[model samples]
Target: MARSPQRLSGTPDDQTSPIPGRVTAPALRRGLDILELFLDSSEGLRVPEMTAALGIPRASTHELVGALVDRGYLQPKPGSAGQFVLGVKTFQLGGAYERSLDIVEAGREAARAVAAECGETVQIVVRDERVVVYIVRIDSTHSVRLVSDVGSRLPAHCTAGGKVLLASLSPEELATLFPDDTSLLPMTTRSIDTVERLNRELAETRERGWGEEYCESNQDVACVAAPVRNPRGECVAAMSISIPTIRWQDDKRADYVALVSTGARELSTRLGARL
Candidate 1:
């Protein structure tokens, strides 16, 4: 009689069974695990310490560390033997990753979301010396709205977004920008026209974590803005919402402030900021 074929035993989910077409390298996995251990370690780690932390064989840990050192992914700590830290290669990779982030696109999405929430015109701007340059704008659905467009430049002391950006600068930097305590140019009668007054408003902006302009940039327009920060916690831009003066309500100022602040925080988060 013909013999029956042998039967396979374990299910695909069994630990001992290898899945079909699934490629894995134990050595590479172990090597990566070793690198990850250093993330939580402030000081350099020795091969033995890594081996203990990762539960890899001491010999394997040595081999992996040697390979990483040779590849410039790790380097020996200064004046320390057999202890390694992340290498210059990691810094280079980090810079590349940061450079790859596109602030304009991120701001555009953030502006759209905020505009949708508040039903007002939203804008994103960056500081240019004593001025703020608009980079993104989302128009309000209302028939009447602020008409500022992308690429438009405005006095830093006269607009909410501009004030927010200016507030991010140091006192010395502000002094350098203004150069003197002379009165600034006015966009309208309500605009802040003196360095002293602008400084006071900027202080208020910093204290409240947002900025506001009432008939400053335009007689018939008012605005609120908040700062957008990057991963390094540096203010990179300002996000603002403009309201027609006729529609502006003092009672609703708090609501506008909350909306613009939330939008700025969202944009900051998208830029990799922790908060």
Candidate 2:
């Protein structure tokens, strides 16, 4: 089957962008890009800073910066002079993302169910810049267990949810996603140490439609994960459970695996996935 055309650059810089009648103007896109960097840093950015952050020419950045400041997208901070911060409009724009009800509704149901069934921590993550962004978390029942929070970033190669997400991606896509000679950061001694090993493991995950982690992130933690696919059958996210190695023995282990699999399938069903 043919895949629908997606905007590769996401910049909306093309003259023939989308429906042909509408296109993202260069100044609007650059201004938005410059405005986005504010969320990542504590200090406000200057024209020279924006130029360096975007790699756009200093002349163009200066003009865009001026336009943004004039339009109230960027304003001066109280304590800092010459440094410009995100204005009211910027936050107002971000409020729209906060108001998004679907993501909240989906996450609330998923977090509660997974945590209730497994009696352990569960997280739903979205891939962001070769890392998994932990968006929701449900705490464990036991005193000794894994803990994670929303807005935390973890390596994609070392976590059960991350590996399941990786398995859903194509090799070509992986190559495009990861930087050259990417360093495989090991959280524990058992973390996959090389591209070759990680590749092989992800392949197995794809085949099984599930992922398992044995002290890969922490020496005492064990986890199993399965994907929550979308209506299109693409793995959009994952549901997982964390268990202490001491509890992951015998029939207890089987119970953990079964719970994770069933929970993931249920989440996928809620997402409108057929399988």
Candidate 3:
């Protein structure tokens, strides 16, 4: 019978080992590193393997693993005494994380339904400090839909959804997010070019309860967006529809605005917002 290979004692300065001195909790850091190790492993890990890979003392490794087991973060592998794997609690936490996201449950269905209804690309965006991130996207059947995909980031001043999200922030938050007025970088000739212009646009967006972008993020695309709110009336996201400029008509702007605003409202209601 072939024997299993022994776990090698990794060097202290090795790339895999978490560097010390940055955090105050050594034991907690070790525990987190141990958990991260499984991201690279397909099988359960043993105490000796953890100790060797992390360069932690055997007793400390055992104690940390034992504590994790007691907390239900780790469990002994089935039929393998001394080997451990992530526990049900870890999966439970992951599920909770997924469920707690308002967009995951409410925003996705709305985006899909709206895209199908309008035959245009629908997007869900969230503001990340100074930029807007596309969290979800539902594509249109048309061949000329916006090329931006989920996880794409763009300057807040240049996109309809970004403007909607930025409009939701308080004055202080806005000041903090854009400490330097020059940070509002224009993406195209039509994009908001200065902080003063962007602020005026955002104020108008707040008043109208919607935002519009034409040839801003993309020269060939035009977008309309509205804000989505959480239960506490906090704006959590923005939902938008993008259409090719060549296919856009001045007469259809109202209809497009109505569709996006309705989608945003429905998603916000699903997220427990009163409106």
Give the number of the best model, judged by TM-score.
Answer: 1
Q: How close is each model in CA RMSD to the real structure?
A: 10.1, 16.0, 17.3
Clashing residue pair totals per candidate (backbone < 3 A): 0, 0, 0
lDDT of 1 by residue, 1-275 (tens): 11122223222122232467664466666666676676667688888787666555899888988898898889999999888999888778768878989999999999999999988999999988888999999999999998988999998889999899889899999988887656377899999977888889999999989999999989999899999999788998999999999999999999999999999999999887867
Candidate number of the best lDDT: 1
lDDT of 3 by residue, 167-195 (tens): 98888888877767677787888888777
lDDT of 1: 0.85
Model 3 CA RMSD to the hidden true structure, in angstroms: 17.3
Tens-place lDDT per residue, model 2, 1-275, is: 11112343644365444555776676766666777677556667777777776767998987887888788888877887668888887767656543543644686587688789778887777777578887778888989888667888888888888999998888898777654435678889898778888889999998977888899988888888888777557887877787888778656766766777887777766665566
Better of 1 and 3 by lDDT: 1
Model 1 residue runs over 4 Å out of place are: 1-85, 181-183
